[model samples]
Target chain A: MPQTGRSGCPINLTLEQLGDRWSLIVIRDVMFGNRRSYGELLAQSEEGIASNILADRLKRLTASGLLTRRPDPKHRQKGIYSLTEAAIQLVPLLAHMGAWGRRHTRSSKELSVRAELLEKGGAPLWNAFMDELRHLHLGAPRPARSVFGELQAAYEKALARRARYAQD
Target chain B: MPQTGRSGCPINLTLEQLGDRWSLIVIRDVMFGNRRSYGELLAQSEEGIASNILADRLKRLTASGLLTRRPDPKHRQKGIYSLTEAAIQLVPLLAHMGAWGRRHTRSSKELSVRAELLEKGGAPLWNAFMDELRHLHLGAPRPARSVFGELQAAYEKALARRARYAQD
Candidate 1:
């Protein structure tokens, strides 16, 4: 990312850093999927991001300070990537974006469950989730509340409800 | 703008719809710059967006139902673009984005004033701003409060302060 944006406009700068479709997807995987390795990010991606594009985005994200890459102790050839504080702070932005999409777009129930939970849970939930993320990605002490477990349980419950409704 | 996203994830859907750099910029201009006509949107753009990119984004945004383009009454050859209810509802999203960018990025004081105000003012202020936007763009009954005026004044004051600091 460029040190200077097209203009000093905050929105423009944010867009410049993370406005593309792939960058946030990478962040989302790190945050939600816990896919820290390049292979995992590549193979587990539902969006089917191209290998070259994924490689480019990882480099860009690392350079932009949203991600940090470190050598994996287990394998000299492999590197493990982790979210930096900057990327962890994107929870609210991602939550709001997810909320907007759920309300406005042709969203799937299973896919949108997280967004619904985030919207209903609001800032308190978001803060807890971010705290949990810091622990997961940054080695911080885990919070007493597991917002991730709460969110995942909610999502799984919604999925079960949808499965029942589908049978009916 | 495809009907289906790469995945059904709400965040991915939103990214697919608006993940590009220029789409939101076009929206920002129409919403804040009050540049209703194509010419105004083109000429007054701070980012100097290319004409082709602008044309493409306008078409994409209109296709996505974020904007409505109608023949200008004053100029038979010109079209005036207005925000739909969907776009107006984006005030909160934009405000949060601006706030995130202001804190995380190297934003300028003059440019970030609006974001600062939105952060300080929160949802009540966003609702008022959206109401004012609805009045301006959708021809709704104008709200008595001038949130736009208030925001613009804050931006101007920030600009003046920057100018003074520059002189110093």
Candidate 2:
């Protein structure tokens, strides 16, 4: 298919394909939160993505080969969304974006905890997380390490620290 | 200033602030092309951003601390734009995005050369480039090594290669 981009510049093409406010968020929800259905994505999103926008982004992402859609075997009316390998590979990019935001923006401690750990863990952790994601979303063999568990533990620890600080 | 991001999640915050098709492109032009004036940005842009959108994004970027705008000493009626520390920090994110695009999307050889070099050069090159940008835009002392020159040279070589291929 002819690429529908403003220009052939790789960055511009990427932006054209997934540069909107909602596309990567949809991918993030699917990849990180394991929200496989539209309803799950709509209800669980922290960013309050509108249903219409979510619908549009899902179609776009699926068309762009970043996501795959199939009828839910458990419920035919609902479609299940899963990340393509392309979307799964975006872990590093999202990790870097999260790290940058944590440093430069006024982010919430709880919300930014994952980004901090990702930054601290660097690419090795990112690769491990991607492996876990593949197992979850693509039926791949699970990696030996649980980077997700490590990240969650770190976040919980950070939250506990914040709570102690609040009391002090 | 209170951040205007949609959520405290670092990725969501970054996207809300700059997930549009044009915001990062504008920053990229200012950072890479050294387009310091509005007319220069508008006229030299490959994507043909509408004037109203450019104006609005410039205002938003300035407000969000990604860009600084100043009265032009050469022209009283016009203004000069420069990347702030926040924007200079976006180099890695943009680079990764570019690299991903080159891998997954149809991309131009000449346009993707910078991203290729960035992937090859990694953090040391990014740090050097950021140091150079700080000196150029923020009055910091210039680094002895010119990462910018190296990137420019790579782009020029890629363009020449593309030209030779086109002729053949």
Candidate 3:
């Protein structure tokens, strides 16, 4: 059984753990591919989260078992962040949120592209995405490569497009 | 076309509008039972949202097109709050959130029961619930008596259970 802290509502508890504005963005960055260091998250976020708040949210997220941090293998000074199993379970929630937002909010080309893919992919896409991450990061059994090759390709394409705009 | 106020990412915009802790709770109260009167909201909520903040949220929600407020027919000083189409759309989101929380968090019996019902009923239940509200507030056609009857039974059961443990 999961632990109940104070409130009895599940949504309230989830909010207590991951409701802040910055936390989900951080998770998004990590899930999407920006997991190298804190600086990357700070620079890439659209919300312009403050440095202190970002740092605090990262620490809280780590402590809450949503994410884990390790010293960067390439650079001792940098911290490499990765999602735990608990955090990966959030893919469905994130996908739904993204789809909802896409339906209601003004669409950016990039956001709409991502949302469209997420909508089509649904739970299978989310599960496959999680499986790939687990295989890559934690040495879990490699899922059938065919399952995620297209997703990986699309994600890479998105990343390249982002890089061009990011440099300009 | 949906208007994106900021970036194209639907999740970010949604977060900007409905991500706050209190906003969803306020919406839940209005959708579930709490209708008009500021005092009733304050009295019922266990979170004890600050009056100024609650007032501000209510105003913002109304301005944002999620809720509507009208002069209460019974009490001139009171404003009867009703959910707009946009707010009604959030029933599924809230239901999903509640379901996720129940699966992952330790919650009270009352909340757990509600979550279980929501999970079992899914979108159909959400639609039925919203249709009932529309009829009550907007004079839409009434739904099947059985549908309303089941919803009322569940809602009343939850309320009574909550009252047993109500704090002063």
Candidate 4:
């Protein structure tokens, strides 16, 4: 399909396809948070994504081939959203973005934990995480290394640290 | 200053700062296209940015610390804009973004040449380019290698190829 974006510069095209305030956020949820259902995305939204905006972004992302929606087998009426290969490939970009934010923005310790790990771990970590995502979302064989576990463990540690600090 | 964005997730924070449609485009022009002044940016806008939007984004980017503006020595009435360390560091993210678009989106060959080279050259090229940007925008000493020359040459070659293809 022809890109109807403002320009054909690859960055502009990428932005045209996915530059909204919430599109990447939704993909982040799918890729990292493992939130698949519309309800889960809305309820678990750390950014407090409004339901209408979430619904619209879901539709747009699905149309743009970043996501695919299928009927939740357990509930025929509910749909599970999965990231497409396009969105799956966004790991490095997301890593860099997170790294920039960690350095520049004011973020909660628990939230910045993932960005810190991703930056420190670099490409090997990003690739391993991508492999694990392929296993989870694309049904690829599970990789022996679970970078996801590593990242999640770090985040949990930060959360525990915050709890202790709070009690103090 | 505290982040006014919805959440502190690094990705979300980065997006909150730079996620708008035109913010990065303006930066791209300044970084890659060498369009610094308001006139240069407005006149060379690839996406044909509206005058008001360009004006607004320039102010926002300047206010957000991604860009700095100063009265032009040549023309005191017109201000020259330069990228800050924060914006200069966006090279990797922009590179990944462009690479993804080249793989996934429909783009004109000429405009995508830089993205193609960036993907092929990888981090080394990005670092060289960032060094070049620092020299140009931040008054750093010029680097030994000029990835900008390589990227611009590739784009020119592609533009000529497109012209020849059209003539055929």
Candidate 5:
């Protein structure tokens, strides 16, 4: 179909698109921290992806429909990047990767907490989490019963706490 | 710990080592097929990984203890690469990645068959598959019973079929 991959295997094709080192880190920032601006993503990434590489990956990911870049209503020079439905669906993959890492590698206590929460919540939680984002920004259908209500509340609380610290 | 990774998150550390485009592909070739030599690996990889990049990745993987390379007993010019226990443990991750690909992307029919086999076999099957390699090359302990009897049997049958075809 598309001429973007070396093999016809879907997994290989997807890996060809998303398997690079920087792309997932960018996606991780978008999915976890609500960090979409270039500066926010670049700052949060521990890997120190080059600015050129970051720009290239952002362009490619957007072209692939995994991310969307829209004009920031609040800022003129900045663009807000958001995950698309296809990208949001990757939460399971990301969660599994994180879980595997937690099991096999040395991880931080705070990181493990997030991984455990995601694991305990399972696919339904991820689905509802995505639905919440859609409801907030994309006007998509809402979850049947606000399944992630408490988790989202907790997340918001944490964000507010961080914002308060930033003020100081 | 060694100063190689960006974060204490185990996944990040593992990704630091294995997150590149070529590392997993190299591991996959060693695990699934009988590819061991530099020439064989290069031949099997359709994506045309740069020779320098391939050399670098192989060295890094070996340094990380995921693979071991030695002189080919029968061929002095070639080196025989074998998977270590760490690499074998990656079967689950690889299987999951393949399954994810099969579920989401367009893939090759032949490759999908292999992925389905891995999926149906589950983790124990993956363990047994690794044990088979260990027994064959590494002198590692064998399973109490024929844990991967079916898979081993299938491999033999396929080998025989290939021999017959080659003779014809």
Candidate 6:
């Protein structure tokens, strides 16, 4: 991110903030997997994000106000990263991105299952998911909707299906 | 980009397609500015994209199936570019991204005006805009809604407002 010198398009501004592949990947991990600590994010990285890159993205996201880092009370040195309201609002955009990818890419059955659910679930699901995120990351009241649970269950089922297919 | 071995998250796959800053900028020009020719895109660029980068992104986008290119009938050697159905479907994601930028970044008022309209207009406007994009880029029958017109008018109005403010 450069100094705030832009007087240009909003999408360009957004691309500056999020165009880096790793930034959104990190955000996805946090948003979906509830990976907060650096260790959790690094350990669970499906794309094998490098340590230095993860560190830099975490710093950048914090600086960009998409995330906030607070010292983990359980550990002196560790930080717990939480999504801000702005990032919570990204549910729809993420849903759209996922939906687009599932439709267009050679995405795997197991991985794309979530996107399929999101596309099927639409705005109501996205909003419910956002409320859930707010509860998880921002201390908002817990919503009755369990989109996160549903998405996780779907992913697990797809994984099982892939496993059975692989055995054949 | 790396030959479709990915069996990962849809957002990651989508990010692989769209994480580049220049690609979306070029798409924005085509979608919003209606700049199909390389010459037209180069001349009207607000962010001063280099010719080589633009050419390369155009080639990549065409190869990636988000855009298609055909030799301009009016010109011997020049080519005209147009968005594919997949690209047209990106309106909602682009709208969300622009809205996020407007909310979080130092985006100028005149530039962010379009984002504001999209955010306020929401899905109906985005669907209308997509229909208009389909009409322009895919030879679909022209829709009754003219979101493109409204966005263009709003942008021009903002530009005039900017010009007036610059005098002070």
Question: In DockQ terms, which candidate is top?
Answer: 4
State each model's C-alpha RMSD to the native.
Answer: 1.7, 2.5, 5.0, 1.9, 5.8, 1.9
TM-score, cand. 4? 0.96
Q: Which DockQ-derived CAPRI band holds candidate 4? A: high
lDDT of 4 by residue, A1-168 (tens): 224687888899888877778889999998888899999999999989999999999998999898899999999999999888888899999999999998778867799888888889988898899988888888899999988888789888998999999999
DockQ comparison, 4 vs 5, better candidate = 4
Query: What is the C-alpha lDDT profile of model 1 across B1-168, one tens digit per residue?
Result: 454578989889888999988899899888877888889988988888999999988888888999999998888899889999989988878888899899889988888899999989988998999999999999999999998898889888888888898899
lDDT of 5 by residue, A1-168 (tens): 133668765456667767776677788777776787899878877667678888888888889888888988888788888888777767766766776677667776544555666768866777777787676446687766663456455556666776788799
Model 2, position A37, has a per-residue lDDT of 92
lDDT of 5 at A146: 61
Model 5 residue runs over 4 Å out of place are A1-4, A103-106, A116-168, B1-4, B117-168
Candidate 3 chain A lowest-lDDT run of ten: A1-10
Ranking by TM-score: 4, 1, 6, 2, 3, 5
lDDT of 2 by residue, A37-57 (tens): 999999998888899999888
Worst 10 residues of 3 chain B by lDDT: B1-10
Candidate 3 per-residue C-alpha lDDT over A114-158 given as tens digits, one digit per residue, 9 for 90 to 100: 666867986677778889778755668988854345645675687
DockQ of 1: 0.83
Q: How well is each residue in B1-168 modelled by candidate 3, as lDDT tens digits?
A: 122354556777888787766788788777664455677887776566689988988888888888888988888888878888777777667777777777766766665666678779866787788787777657789887444467557767987977876853
Show model 6 residue runs off by greater than 4 Å.
A1-6, B1-7, B165-168
The DockQ value obtained for model 5 is 0.41
**Tens-digit lDDT string for candidate 2 (B121-160):** 8888888899999988898998999887887898898888
User: Candidate 5's fnat?
Assistant: 0.54
Please report the interface RMSD of model 1 to 1 decimal.
0.9
Point out the higher-scoring one by TM-score: 5 or 6.
Answer: 6
Regions more than 4 Å wrong, model 2: A1-3, A157-168, B1-5
Docking class of 2: medium
The true-versus-predicted C-alpha distance at residue B164 of model 3, in Å, is 10
Residue A158 accuracy (lDDT) in model 2: 85
